[model samples]
Target: MPTTRSALMVAATAAMLAGCAKPPEAPPPSSSAYRVYVTNEASGDMSVIDSATMNVIATVPLGKRPRGIHASPDGKTIYVALSGSPIAGPGMDESTLPPPDKSADGIGVFDVKQNKLVRVIHSGSDPENFDISKDGKRLYVSNEDVAGVSVLDLEHEKVIATLQTGEEPEGVRISPDGRWVFVTSEDAGTIAVVDTAANKVVNSFKVGRRPRSIAFLPDSATAWVNAENDGTVVLVDAVKHTVVDTVQLGERGVVKPMAVLLSPDASTLYVSTGRGKKVFILDVATRKVQASIEVGQRPWGIALSPDGKTLYSANGPSNDISVVDLATRQVSQKVKLTGSPWGVITLEQ
Candidate 1:
């Protein structure tokens, strides 16, 4: 009934409104294949590798310094810690590096099905590592530059708390029972225990020099922390939050333990030595060295396969992933990646 000119104007306005509206989210997948994700810190992208074929399937662009990577409890989403801080390795001069772009620091939320970054949650300053709650509502993130831990509420997408910690906090992990949140302070050489319910640090104890990573048993009775400078892994009494023992992997200064991962059965402990260029296998029951597999240069992040038959190490310097076959305790394949790979995680969907 309207004139052609008026009808065209209305149609154009409607189209503009439609373009401004938010796009609908991709529907959840009914089925998915197993894939390994690696975060490249230098190039600011994530590599998706097909587990069945042992080949890289896709590369998703993330942001600056994507270091820590973890999946949601439901395996629907992956959260990566992205930082704008300039890279300063051991013995490197920090003063020479450029200033940090504070705006680029946040936790990247990637939708597994879409293989894309859905959003970025504010995670305080310089988030290096983080762990999710059992129900997956909250994220305990280590604010490395601020020397504190930020508690981010996923539903509200806001930081609920910023708890204090020692200097240069890096590794973050929650106990299996979900009663405690553990954060490692690298420069302080200590672990801060946060009571989840109380939402505060209840205890802080020294493990050893330069502790960076933590692994817990299934029962949550004990935990193992890497003492990087000491070239040893320290066993902790998870309940008492006390150190029980230390297992030497190699000579100090050479064998710097970076990441600790436990087998599904909790029978074996796998440790990636940063500069040592090896993954040390230890017998959990006896706390003895079982074997040391040479992986690559600066193997920092390690993950066990879903079936528990293979291990993947993110070698930062080599810019590749070393696939270790657990049965042979040897490196079976090396998957090349662009940029410096910092963290690796496997998801079977």
Candidate 2:
């Protein structure tokens, strides 16, 4: 009888200890557990798409010509470039269009939680594209019309410095090391390297004809930039600001590379060919084109899923985004968007 009672008490004590023990921690969320945000240039609004459903859940109104979109380091805020300059296509007469509205030219600050534009930062004249600092305290913006790069202080909400770059500066990228910011000038076909510490243009080097966008490797030692008019991607030595090699995408005048993005592992390079209507996948080691998938007309902006299993391309003329599955090298779906989809980015929810 005593042995039986002691066993029961021991079992009870074990149960009590088990109940008091801490539970196991929940696993981290997968990459798809997020939302996709796209900027529509023609509609002047941002489309919020649920990543899982791949449907447009909300449309947040922004100012005129919202193009470049990027999220803060914490993914709590979004910054979009709002331009009032009339759309002047290549060779178009700017004198025929309406006068630029200076008031609408600024960077739209958006609150992710509020799902609205909280404020507008007066970055500079004709703010087209920009890249935020690693600390999210500063923004390096490219003023296309002004032909300069403006360094804006997020804390003060003002432009601290504006350094003259090449003509028609459009693409702005900060190196992975956070030491230099690179701006691409389409007309000049050159890249202007800015020293982040000094906020000055330290070097300018020609890459190709009409360099459009740039993507840097994880180590920040190498960079890949697209030369639109040349129909090629130039491999650049990030440290020296010099071109090491050029990989011809296609015949000039037919294939115009617009945006370049590196894989998470930096093993593959993706190039979105504007007007070429296709996205080319290339092996970085061999610098050889592995495959090409026809996405849509004028695919300008490209982004990869967090897991690196999927790719999304913003088709400006088609008004849709191509969702590609990297494993099969095929487009799995096309998410339609209102107006011309100019830029695309994914953020964790």
Candidate 3:
């Protein structure tokens, strides 16, 4: 009798489940959802490109010299570095140029869904570039003119701490573990490794002449610094806080490296040579340049998709974005951007 009751209960439960409404299937990804955002530094604006159509849909005016772009880890917001510091060349005298409009320095925050500039937030004077924490609670900003990095609290939009750095700090990168931040001092030619918890420069080491940009591995075990003037990529051991090796990008005075990008798996690296007009493919284990893909002239910033299928480079001199097919290692398209493109970031829906 007990077995019969158990069978009856099972039958009743199955009948109830069968009569219940079925769950709906998830929809496929929309083709037009992918987008590429390019910052035009010289134009003081940013252009939004629709990747599906390969056409620029809109250009939003930002403050003076919009550069160094990065999206929040959640992909809901984008932050761009904006500055009004007088633009002076290498040989130009700073005194002759107009004083940096400290008032014009700020970080522009944009809403992804709204497709509009939400507000302009100021962290410190001349926020040239910055890196947001994984939790999106903080931002480490490299103040180009001030020779330090301003750590800003995201919720309040105010600088919480200032970490001293070398002269003319330009590039700021945070480790995956969030324990350290590596800042490149352009004029000082050194990397200032900061311990975020202590909010101070923990270690400093010479990389090469004019280290402008840097990229780190997923494990935070190694980092690569772009030695622009020397035309080489100096590899650094993050754990040891030392320069492990140096890999030459191109000939002297010809291949000025502007940026370094690591693959999703950290097995390969891609370097954008500024004057070389090409992106070099590197094998991680061997640390050798396997091949070079010719991109537009003066490629400055580089970004890769989540799937690592497509690569985008902001070509400054040519005023365009070179879309490269990583599988084929060839230029698939050149999307024209009217202004001088400085930095680029892409999001795939």
Candidate 4:
């Protein structure tokens, strides 16, 4: 019974309302694919490589000396360690040294979506390596010079606690359950196990000379500490907090093992020998070297893909990443970077 104009207006309004209705929901993310991020220390840049393509898709510029790199558990952000320390020693004192021309020596936060460095969170002095809590609420950063761990609250983006550790803490890792943090002391040759809830060092155990890197098995029952100077990997039982076994990788004075990585299934362990220029694959059950692949010179960091089909080693002197196919057990590809690539991390989207 409405007039013609009124009828037309009503129809137009109904049509507009229909158009404003929500569209169909977006499909979920592809579960099969992922990305890999590698930090180049000398180049001051990071390389973003597509897992499927094995090609460098983007290069993100970060602060000077971007070394230790880690991806958030959600795969939403990448944290890189930017050291402002002097090339010779820990440069002049922070107060006396000239202010940084750009970003300071801290954690460079990169938003994965934008592929850019979004912020630099000031950690303690000489933030070398770091680890995030299992719940993703806290970040434990190892300040090498300060000889402690700076616990950063992710939600607040500030350092809330600094727990004193051994001398020259180089590698820091949180347990899978998020209850304990293990820090390796390069100069002290010890590992400090921190109880997260209590925020205290529960125990400190002796390791080999210069414990530079640490890795835990998937079950979280055992951990492997790499002694760079001793050329050995010490296996520690987490519960007992004791060294259960020590597997010698290279000769007493020949090889230098820098980083340790476990396979996705936790059946194999991989160690990068710096002076040997080889990646040693060890069978976890037997604690013996199963294979050794000659990689580039001075491989400092190593990471395995999600599927455990590929291994990536960052060769410092070669300034390239050696991609080894797990099945073939050889270098499949070497991706060149701008500078010395040290920290390599794989991301599954």
How accurate locally, in lDDT, is each candidate?
Answer: 0.94, 0.93, 0.89, 0.86
Clashes of each: 0, 0, 0, 1
TM-scores of all predicted structures: 0.90, 0.90, 0.89, 0.86
What does candidate 1's lDDT look like per residue over 1-349, in tens digits?
Answer: 9999999999999999998796978753334357899999999999999887787878999999999999999999999999999988766787899999999999999998788999899989999999999899999999988999999999999999999999999999999999999999999999999999989999999999999999989888899999999999999999988889999999999999999999989999999998899999999999999999999989999998898899999998889999999999889999999999999999996
Best by lDDT: 1
Candidate 4 regions with alpha-carbon error over 4 angstroms = 1-32, 88-103
In angstroms, give how far residue 108 of model 4 lies from its true place.
1.0
Pick out the ten consecutive residues of candidate 1 with the lowest summed lDDT. 25-34
Residue 229, candidate 1: C-alpha displacement in angstroms: 0.5
Reference-based TM-score, model 1: 0.90
Q: What does candidate 4 score on TM? A: 0.86
Candidate 4, residues 1-349: lDDT per residue as tens digits? 9999999999999999988896968763333487778998877899888877677878889988888888887889888988876433323455766544333678999999888999998887878899988667888999887799999898888898899989889899887777789999988899999999988898998988889888887767889999888889999998888889999987965788889888877889999998789999999999999989999988988998888899999998888899999899989989887788889988876
Model 2 off-target regions past 4 Å? 1-32
How close to the true structure is residue 264 of candidate 2, measured as C-alpha lDDT? 88
Enumerate residue pairs that collide in model 1: none
Between the candidate structures 1 and 3, which one is better when assessed by lDDT? 1
Tell me the RMSD of model 1 versus the true structure.
6.9
